[model samples]
Target: MSTLQQLLREIDAKQKRINKQRPLEQTKIKNLKDYFKVGLTYASNALEGSSLTEIETKVVLEDGIAVGGKSLKDHLDAIGHGRAFDWMWELAKGVAISEEDVKKMHVLCFQPSEGEQAGEYRHVNVVITGSQHNDRLPSHEEVPALMNAWAVGLPEKRKNRHPVQYAAQLHQEFIVIHPFADGNGRVARLLLNHALISQGYPPVIISPVFKHEYIQALEQSHTKPENFTAYIAEQALQAQRDYIRLLRIE
Candidate 1:
């Protein structure tokens, strides 16, 4: 097996053990797990060159209905129109970005015309506004090149950083760059999970239940490295806990 495949198998084994311990309803848990897996799969596949529109069409709509017939970008926006609310909802339920949110995330990740929308805070040079750190705002010209550079740079960074920290760093950098006119927060979270899943870590859910803490942790990324790292680490440990609970393993 390829290294990536082997690592995933190990992650699955770990997740299974965690799942066994939780007292969640079997059917509900199964559905939730399926949705989660589908969401992650969609993300990885898209990054691997799957068509975004095709992936969105397959994952977002329920009961065989097309929401929009636009290009991939437009379709993403149509699907993700109300993603901020959805993101908070999923986080409340101990899930991170869902397949639905992933579609939205794809739409809002990085737009080419966000030079003004992405105002840069002079303090730390990371892209966030007061009390709400969204995505990085780049010059329209800068967005495409940055993403291309990131695509090349991310793998090495992922390997070197602790999985949780790596995930947070990606999240931070995404926001710092503010690549989109909108959807920066949601996309950043999605990128965070992609980092984890790629490395065989369970999806780290930023529970909206912990929104206060979540925002606080992100805010600290400006000057407090340890604080930021701790926040992501705490979330990672929770995913490990939840997985262990679900699988009922020692």
Candidate 2:
């Protein structure tokens, strides 16, 4: 069987357990596994294809590097804190971000440059997987169109589907488009949590701890079109586990 399909089956099985263990996630392995998945996904998105050894070193130092000096662990911690903060704040208000707000939020997140002050909002094209080779941007004009499709067709039924699924889809689509000069991953992650927070699920944290697996999933999606969905679904399942783990459940 294809890896993606295998992952799907695994996700469905895990989902059944997660639903049953809801509210009491900390007591069960099933719940812990799901939360672990969340930490992995956030780490994956933040530090895709990064090295763990380097991540640990920088993590110990607690220093934020502009572009390269930062390690995988640093990315994980940064994203985790950001997601948690947003999740808690949004939860208290009983509110969700609008599409307009998504764009503005992304702009704000991408504003800070290494040498510049915070809040610089990028207006240039972003290229992933090596900007030199994949320098093409997914037309800025098409961003809203694509986002609209994602917003409308996201997985998980309007009322029944886990909010994480929507957040995952939004993140994948945003990264695929490479919409900004910087902070695309961070923006995608923020949008991802917005969906989850709105739905009342704890924010998903993708840890740099699983950087390798995360990149492999994205690489599979980019190289094999038929497998992208499966890849994404699998990634989401893993992310669920990370979230549970962070909460110290199980």
**Highest-scoring model, TM-score:** 2
Off by over 4 Å in 1: 1-32, 35-105, 108-141
lDDT of 2 at 149: 66
Each candidate's lDDT (Cα)? Answer: 0.54, 0.51
The TM-score of predicted model 2 comes to 0.55
TM-score to native of every candidate shown: 0.53, 0.55
For 1-250, candidate 2 gives per-residue lDDT tens digits of 9675676566666556555545663456444333433443335344744443334433432343433665644454444433443443444245445455555554333333233422333445445653333533466566656666655555334355434444555666666776555556666666666665455444555566565655555555554544545545655676557554555445
RMSD of 2: 6.9
RMSD of 1: 11.9
Deviating ranges (above 4 Å) for candidate 2: 1-6, 24-97, 107-122, 129-136, 141-168, 193-204, 223-226, 239-250
Q: Write the per-residue lDDT of candidate 1 for residues 116-163, one digit (tens) a residue.
A: 333221223244456543443465567656655665666687667656
Worst 10 residues of 2 by lDDT: 110-119
